[model samples]
Target: MAGDKAVSTVSKPVMRGLLNSSIKRNLTVALTLAAISGVAFKQLVGNERKRKYAEFYRNYDAEKEFEEMRKKGLFQSC
Candidate 1:
């Protein structure tokens, strides 16, 4: 048994290279998806803001709103 020896099929350097490649691929995918999601979310938020503005102005009169605020004593007496 003195002449018998064991050897690994894969070495440390090869394993490290494979691991690095995998990490790089996953990182690239994650970053790409994150960026796309962020852009999509911003678009959704912008559309929602426009909708809300339209809703607010549907029955809005600036003069009436100001008059109501004045009635509530919201303005300073300057």
Candidate 2:
């Protein structure tokens, strides 16, 4: 009975250590993934803003072209 008790005590600490190690590893992976996702999201937002700016300038130039057309009497104004 005494030998069994000693073995059980030793096993308990070993089990606890294993559990702690597993938890630490999982937390490290989660933090790494979160950082990677944040960086990717920032890049996507930057690219989207650049595309929108380009589109806005294209539309603005088209309007200027129309004004020039009006000046040239390409179509009669209402």
Candidate 3:
């Protein structure tokens, strides 16, 4: 197809430039960017999960629950 040929021709120069350039440096930059973005994405997700857990536990009554468990004889006297 003419369109396919045109697209390939357009891309050839770009690909050729990448191949002719400092490939190691380009790869390093790309890898560094990927690592940074990955870390940022992980941190974002982790922070969101932490916030959700914190919000969920904000109204939790740990002492009351423990007392109830003790009253139920769930734990031995220590």
* lDDT (C-alpha, whole model) for all candidates: 0.86, 0.84, 0.84
Off by over 4 Å in 3: 1-30
Q: Model 3, poorest ten-residue lDDT window?
A: 8-17
Clash pairs (backbone) in predicted model 3: none
TM-score of each: 0.56, 0.43, 0.47
Q: List residue ranges in candidate 1 displaced over 4 A.
A: 1-13, 57-59
lDDT of 1 by residue, 26-73 (tens): 999999999999999878997889889999999789999889999999
Instruction: Please give, for residues 1-78, the per-residue lDDT of candidate 3 as tens digits.
Output: 768866643344465567657788888999999999999987999889999999979988999989999989999882
Ranking by lDDT: 1, 3, 2
- What is the TM-score (0 to 1) of candidate 2? 0.43
lDDT of 2 by residue, 1-78 (tens): 768866744344566579889989999999999999998987999788988999988778777788889888899652
- Could you tell me how far off, in angstroms, the CA of residue 56 lies in candidate 3 after the best superposition? 2.7
